[model samples]
Target chain A: MGLLKKRKREGGEIPTASMADIAFLLLIFFLVTTTIDVDTGIGMVLPPKLEDDVEPPPIKERNVLKILVNETGQVLVEDQPSAIRLIRDEVKKHVLNEGVDPRYSEAPGKALVSIKTARQTPYDAYVGVLDEVWMAYFDMWDSEARRLGFPDYATYSAAVAEQGAENQIRDKIKAAISIAEPDKQ
Target chain B: MASSHFKKKTSVKQEIPTASLPDIIFMLLIFFMVTTVLRETTVQVRTTLPQAEALTKIDQKRLVSYIYIGPKKLDGNRLGETGVQIDDALVEDMGSVRTIMYRKLIEQPKLIVSLKVDQTSEMGIVLDVQQELREAGALRINYSSKREIPS
Candidate 1:
């Protein structure tokens, strides 16, 4: 009977006086140490590395849209000195070549927009050339999307918002821009 | 009309309980501590990545290996000298990139080598780095640049 009888418990609570202080300390620590960096870039998938150079089958010259950026930052579209701003329109026209010029690409699929930059070319110049090429593809996609009834087809966010024919539009607009190995001057 | 309520009022002083405040705060603190990931490496050399209108974000940070190309921070000795930084270390010869990155490729097979190059730097250095990277078989590359919001 005595063993079965338990002592009376005392009312006690956890010491939370310092809880807010501790929380504030931690919040401050994180606030001070946090680095919310927004990182986004141009993604490129490079072909596998080769041990030795190999010869390839010959292809017709009509499909090639050769763009050359020399060491002195001279950008030439099909061996002609082209202004930076001209690259987008020139690339677009060449890619969708309506047979305007005999040297431009015949079709988008057969068209190869090859970018070759010299060793001494400035990074800005090189990226500028690549950006213009990318812009050409983006513009083509935009115009095509606009034709499909999406009037505001400027950025990817605009396309993602629309409900109909997403995959169809995306597949048709996806253009492959091949970057050749850099030529050492 | 409120006489009964007034009559029932106690003389004991009432105090707000704050003992549980720390626990709530601690829980929040722990949540933050667990979720926070320190990814940005302490950059040694000065780098100014070029801006581009089109960009894509790499969701997974683990798959990326940064190759920083820029002039070393001006400290009198290294003024006007452009150097290559792989990860966090400053590498000297361009030839070493292949070997260095090759080991990284072995560790992470699908490594995305992001080139965070300065706009003013010569393309020669970048090309050399790319040549080495190709030889190293670290193919999946990303050109790291800030978003160029039109003026």
Candidate 2:
């Protein structure tokens, strides 16, 4: 019976001479049709458009840190010629305030970083400065989590394991970086 | 005892089995075909995106629209001007950007306008585009960028 079954299986050897053609054709089709660009970005939510002209509330001068980027991509922090790398430290200092300078904010909740860019500023400079400011907030959050008894937060998944403690802090002290309207050239 | 009894000599030709080669290749081909996404539009602007470390990846492709701003392709025939491309066509004026994007937002209310600008492009042109988008009520913007600076 086993011999009969084996004989029947080998009775007809199917031809595969055109197998390469079929495979090549399918491969070519996919190669031609494939769009492999993996899109990623930095998402930002713009404040909703004003419904009508109303008296905008005035912000205290102490709480606002003005960062100006010029046409030649020079960054100025409160009238100081600041390097792109220093924006993070400057932002950290201002946001935390830490009772160091009364000119800066009193607390993270009160601090607002206003970035005003000239029309001709290079897009690279704009994004570079923005990135540094965000990094400052992120670094603060990391340390904040670690300071709250999660020693392994930065290295291990300690904060995440604590069930929303770190995320709560992140939500409370969101980066309040605002983009002011540009000066028309 | 059964193995010894079944060990009768038989004459058969030894050959490499090539019959299943096509089947294996065809399976791989099918995988590639299933994974491929067709390109919907051809890009006209020459853009090399800037790099940033703090990037947030959007999960849904359906809720996104792309805006390409850069110098016209420096290679072949040059337009001699920076161009803005939205949905496969070069925008002639800044005003039209609002109308076209307003129509897109009508279709997908949760649509996110992704701005892909060249690194060296002036911020003026970009701010103009942003103003148009704001006027169109497309407030959600994603600045498309690479994850690392190329060394």
Candidate 3:
């Protein structure tokens, strides 16, 4: 017999280490491409705990000039038809005139305007109304402060005096504006 | 002697080397599997949202309270009014909602109190909820809506 055999084993299996790496790469690719979801909302201030022993402020019921927005986007102020665009001016007028009276001028922060919006109303509409309320509040407060001879009086005084020959009218406007400012809690 | 030594000389066997492709592929798969993060779906109530031209994204993690608005159920029939549905009861009065929201706010100062209202629900119902949220000192209020695709 010959020392070496003529026939030899053919087609031996080859080992592969690439499968794990491919799987890992694919997993990484999918993870990097996926997206996450988030929620949205307006800013809020929460009340403190009842157990804190801090005495609660006395509740005073003040008329909050209500602005109601229905599902169809109709704006109603005190049960009257009002345009959405004109809400700021209308609210200003209401806060300064109807919501406040001269008898309550000593207690200017008592008047409040509560904006009641429908849940189904669009976010844009809600924010729009809030912006209007903020503007009206600021305008009314500034005018009132000017009439009362507070610091930075010249700018507000000039704006009020520019209305002309209506000193009584100006005083009434001042009183109305004073009540429009919300009381800080 | 020369004829006896003339035996056939066999050629040496040559071995071919294989590229280490399997090792590379296996490592890539493992890396991806280890790095991938799995996401779980959260339970959400269905509500139709109003469309807007400009909607900004909020990223802060917040405690949200759900408020549902649907028809009032009287007897066995559902009453169709745009009112708040709290704990299986229709809240016709706004004060009750305000009081509850205020209590919740006091309990959790950082709560957001999101409103989930059906699309067909009346604007008045939604507004009432918002007014209550504001009065309760819940300043951070947000509306839940389906994200619109930019076509």
Candidate 4:
């Protein structure tokens, strides 16, 4: 009778000995498939489509700094042949002139940096010129941030961001960069 | 008596407690699962991005749409003509870029088009694509580039 009762009684609990193996399998699969790389790059905003009937606003010749990159990868700052290394200083002087120079901008807020590239210009060359221009603006912003009692521009911007305050530096020193279209090939 | 007590202590079996093994594995699995992106698209073009110093990171990845412009990769380590790739397909006609981008803009108005162009490629194709993007009203763009190693 005892032997029969023992045979009738089944195992009290379901098997969990294989759970660790199953979890290990899933962990291995996920570990093999994970990718942690982040995408980084330069950001820009393109102007919207212009209607045929709308006329473009006119910017003064003196306030606009013309930068041209030709097919040979040569850079021309204000129609004068220049090297890529000189663009940053030239851009800074032009933007920060504050009416001291006759050929430079009237004010930082009104200054315009126009970049025009040829159809055959290498993409890297164009990017190099653009990077210099942006670096000039960043330098100006940093000085402005320091004048306003901050260690650097990034810190000022971050502090302002945390407080939900308007960025006065950006408003005062606007980066008014315009990308001009190249002539048709 | 001391010898008997020492023998009694040595008689007990020693084994590692592994009852929490599944929980530990599950934690690791969750971590990997959260970070995984599952390798979606197979890029057909070779985008050797240009290097630059002025760079900004796009934090919101969901708002990004990629446009790859580079030489078409062919068989046996050869590169063909310059091609434009959107998603997994290569765009044959340049004019269709406007329509395709316009449709994308309709779905996500804040779509930021990330242009991944090869370093040696000319500006002609890049501008053409920009023109198409302007027409499509997807104005926000990112020029994908590597950070310049400071010399």
- Complex DockQ per candidate: 0.59, 0.54, 0.17, 0.75
Q: Please write out the lDDT profile of model 1 over residues B1-151, one tens digit for every residue.
A: 5886776675566788876777777787777676566665767677788889768788777788999988888667564678899877889888899999999999999899999998888877887788799889998898898898799
Q: What's the CA error at residue A5 for candidate 4, in Å? A: 12
lDDT of 4 at B30: 91
Query: Compared with the true structure, what per-residue lDDT tens digits does model 3 show for residues A1-185?
Result: 24233232444443345555655567567657544466543333333224557786653444345666654567776678887668777656655555355322223344455565554554446545554565565566566665667554345556557975444423444322111111222
What are the runs in model 4 whose C-alpha is more than 4 Å off?
A1-14, B1-16
* C-alpha-based local distance difference test score of model 4: 0.92
Give the Å shift of residue A120 in candidate 4: 0.6
lDDT (C-alpha, whole model) for all candidates: 0.77, 0.83, 0.54, 0.92
Which ranges in model 2 have alpha carbons more than 4 Å from their true place?
A1-24, A98-100, A148-166, B1-34, B74-79
Per-residue lDDT of A1-185 in model 4, one digit per residue for the tens? 98766765864555689999999999999888876667788888999999999998888999999999999899999999999989999999999999999999999999999999998899999999999998899999999999999999999999999999999999988988888999765
Error of 2 at A9 (Å): 19
User: Which number leads on DockQ?
Assistant: 4
Q: Provide the lowest-lDDT 10-residue window in model 4 chain A.
A: A5-14
Clash counts for all predictions: 3, 1, 35, 0
Candidate 4 docking category? Answer: medium
Residue A153, model 2: Cα distance from true site in angstroms: 8.1
- lDDT winner between 3 and 4, please give it: 4
TM-score (all chains, Cα) for each model: 0.79, 0.79, 0.39, 0.90
Better of 1 and 2 by DockQ: 1
Chain B TM-score for the candidates in order: 0.78, 0.75, 0.54, 0.84
lDDT by residue (B7-54, candidate 4, tens digit) is: 999899988899998899999999998888774778899999999998
